[model samples]
Target chain A: MSVELVDVAGLDLEAEADRVSARIDDFFTSLLQPPGDSRDQLYAAMRHAAIGGGKRLRPLLTLAAARLFGIDEDQALRIAAAIEAIHVYSLIHDDLPSMDDDDLRRGKPTVHKAFSEATAVLAGDSLHALAFEILAHEATHRDPHVRSELVLELSRASGPNGMAGGQMMDLAAEGQPLDLDAVTRLQQLKTGALIEYAVEAPCIVTRLARDARTPYRGYARNIGLAFQITDDLIDFAGDEAAAGKRTGKDAGKGKATFVSLVGPDRARQQARVLVEQAIDHLSDHGEEADMLRAIARFAIERDR
Target chain B: MSVELVDVAGLDLEAEADRVSARIDDFFTSLLQPPGDSRDQLYAAMRHAAIGGGKRLRPLLTLAAARLFGIDEDQALRIAAAIEAIHVYSLIHDDLPSMDDDDLRRGKPTVHKAFSEATAVLAGDSLHALAFEILAHEATHRDPHVRSELVLELSRASGPNGMAGGQMMDLAAEGQPLDLDAVTRLQQLKTGALIEYAVEAPCIVTRLARDARTPYRGYARNIGLAFQITDDLIDFAGDEAAAGKRTGKDAGKGKATFVSLVGPDRARQQARVLVEQAIDHLSDHGEEADMLRAIARFAIERDR
Candidate 1:
């Protein structure tokens, strides 16, 4: 009863995202149950932060990439869940009082606001640990070598030299005069690393060699930058009610963003160009990659 | 040339600790260098928390356990450094304002105190990611299976079901009275899980089978409790200067500790008895386990 690739033509990515989001919610529901009564509250906090909100874009990227290889759905879902865990954990920590100091996330109280700051911190830490645990588990992959590679790549992407490093740059950049190159590097590290992982992880799971991955890698990189550019555009001009969060935050903080460095017209033009280039990398694939192409278009077109 | 077992008899465990501590320092110095200049400050914050002033007991435990399997010293040092990273990362987060709120750690300013609260969070989070990064690298172990197992064990020990769960319990227990059973469970999940991993990681590196690991498991469980009991005892009556942190904190907070529940004399006696029992678990290894036995004694006798 496998799903047919032909049916995916003219794919509505927003609907596909909602479908994967439902799967992701079920996945988190199963995994977040506290082991014992003592930890019920901690698990609850994790569930609250992770289960209900966000675009689930990273996981969707994983699923879309996995479709290119005909990877097992169950296995791909597990990897997607792991990637989402890392994404949510970063959000939980980023929203803390000491970090971005946000009281609201996705239209509700942030983890630290709903729970205590200490619980929020532990929940974030635990979710980070859970990401690695899922990747290393035997259930994630049959080959130990594949699992090790996944673990290595994800850890490197998230560690001091990767996502965390990018985050440090972001925090330090607030109200500082960062050049366009510096801001690009910061965005690449902050959000681009995980996006790269999402696109590349399925390759690892499918045992694709380095030379064979150039197209996928190129596609991921271009789309990642495009995604960020659109994010900046949304922050600059989108409605708060439509975006589900504060708007014009980059301008408010006087932070350098794509929309700030370039005029809105130029930024939008660049995002459209990048999205077209990203889609060009998928020309080798047919209907199997239709969702990826649709998502590339959606990257620039979406309001949120 | 390798040191002989006969030379390690009547070992100056403190000197051995210092030797391993130096190795751990060198390891962090190499890994914490930022790949690009952008993340130098985050790397700096991680170095500030990890490199200086602590007992380094967990790493010592790893090195000691590796000795029993005749593992390569270089390999053992890498694993030990990874364990130390996790320990230090935990301490960094534990001392944050949202947690224990300690300004001083090891007689120096806590990471949050020395750096900004934001840096402290990133440093700790980055360190946690770094631990798994070290373990998954090919240099940690040649066998991918061994590396995967090491990653799985470490992640499980640190995740929601283990260290984080215990942390949740600790926060919830701050103002409430917990029974001895509750406290014991908390300590087991908090510190005991990692201690067990420290003892057992070498077995994975050596490919030691399940049945052969019973004694090591027994030894680690007993000594882990003994170590926590001794910590409570130190907090009860040790000198602030010698311990390198504030003393009498548990009592001041009116929190229940081993000393508070069992009385000073009985808690001391209990720790000694547990340490002796822990040593007995290593009897089968004869001279090969001398360091393990010595460490059991040291767990109770150390002031900090």
Candidate 2:
């Protein structure tokens, strides 16, 4: 649980999370640190938004997947950091007063609450741009084709038809009767899209063949939905302080969520089934994917 | 001035704008076409924000620059469309209640005013993603290096150090006195960054040498500043109806601008000088860059 390196292939979840978090910290520290004169305020706010907090779940997924391909750690970490930035930016925007209106995230004041709303918006927008910038950099991959594919895939997963499109659906579904199919589709686009991107990114980096990617995509699809269901379950029954954000807000707003749609027991049962299915897709990689298998289990089991 | 084809070398400025606008409209028309089921509203909102209603100046600059290298028109048009999407996304975000708080743009309701706030946010976010998606596509550039270059340059221009950074500076500058240098830096990052990107993107596509791009960069810098100066001038003197969006908001908010830092006549003269300098950089290409030259002149001379 301390800052020591864990056996990455082992099931030391806490140590692995710390490892990912350390990578994120080091990356942002250099990215934002400087003589930073005029832009100090902005750099500070961006740092605050991106640098610390979270379980580093998305980056962990990227790392685990990268390990599956024996990808270089530095290159994988860079991509993981970009994915973390995009996730954090989305969180920042979603917490804005005009959006979810949340005041807390990771048990601290949300970006807009800590900074100004204008700063929050710009910070989020900048992070989104920065994510693509990181992926496009030569440092991310030797192959420009790989770099380009990463950008293309990341944008598709995060953009209008994917992450952004899912968000649009979520907003529209609020207080409306969204059936299971609609909810599943919404979750796939909103949370699922980025999760899929994180898991599939290593495939893109290693230039996995089309057929070789199906298992990873399938693994991602199952876990993506499982992750959201667990999130909803946490919101349904867990403490807000432990969750690091508000809970029950969904029910407060009459938002259609898996837990609400299927009840807490059924939701928990469904998430377990998904975790197994998700792990099943990793069978192709055998023991090389143990970390990924560990993560799929962690998805539904983690309390926070 | 209608949607008729204009002489690319001549000064039929309005006709050229219309031509670019038509290209933009056609591109989005196909992009957001039917069979759009549950996400119809999102697609519709995206179309309304992107298609039609502007001078299409950014896209025109891109097209003009592309033509300088004899780049393929279809390829150039695709890049132009992506640039326009980025521009529109910025506008949509800027018009948000937490940002500029404008209700009008291009003589129509702003995205947030026409749609919901959440919808506007997602639409803008989606468009941002779409911009990168378009650029990273094989259709944008055959070379993966070129595609990565486009993504890198565009992201840098639009991200923290560029457009978003400029916006952060701007929001912080509101109700505060900003000197000429500060204002220049702000404008450079804000409006100038994207303008420079538009002018230089074709250079990336054509794989021009870094040193060979200096003239284009210089030209873009001058015209970018001129564009801002004229915009400030328009805010100072032009009618709101002609300007499309509310003008003089800078003055109303006690925000520093070119016109405010210098007198109106001085700002106008400065813009004129910049336009001359901008056009001078294109002397290397002669009449081959006439469209670019015409656009430079139009930047400072147009009523809007």
lDDT, residue A294, model 1: 79
Best by lDDT: 1
* Model 2: residues with Cα > 4 Å off, grouped in runs: A1-11, A34-38, A239-247, B1-11, B34-38, B239-247
The residue pairs found clashing in candidate 1 are none
The fraction of correct interface contacts reproduced by each prediction comes to: 0.89, 0.84
What are the root-mean-square deviations of the candidates from the true structure over C-alphas? Answer: 4.0, 4.4
User: Pairs clashing in candidate 2?
Assistant: none
- Per residue, candidate 2 scores C-alpha lDDT tens digits across B1-304 of 2223234434466677788889889998888763365567778788889888887878899988988999998999988888888888899999999999999998999988898787788778888999999999999888999999999999999998998888878888878869999999888999888989998999998899999999999999999999899888888876354546555768878899989889888999999999999988988885668788888878876776
- lDDT tens per residue, model 1, B164-247: 888888887876868888888899899999998899999989999979988887889899999999988777776444556554
Whole-model alpha-carbon lDDT for candidate 1: 0.87
The 10-residue segment of model 2 chain A with minimum total lDDT is: A1-10
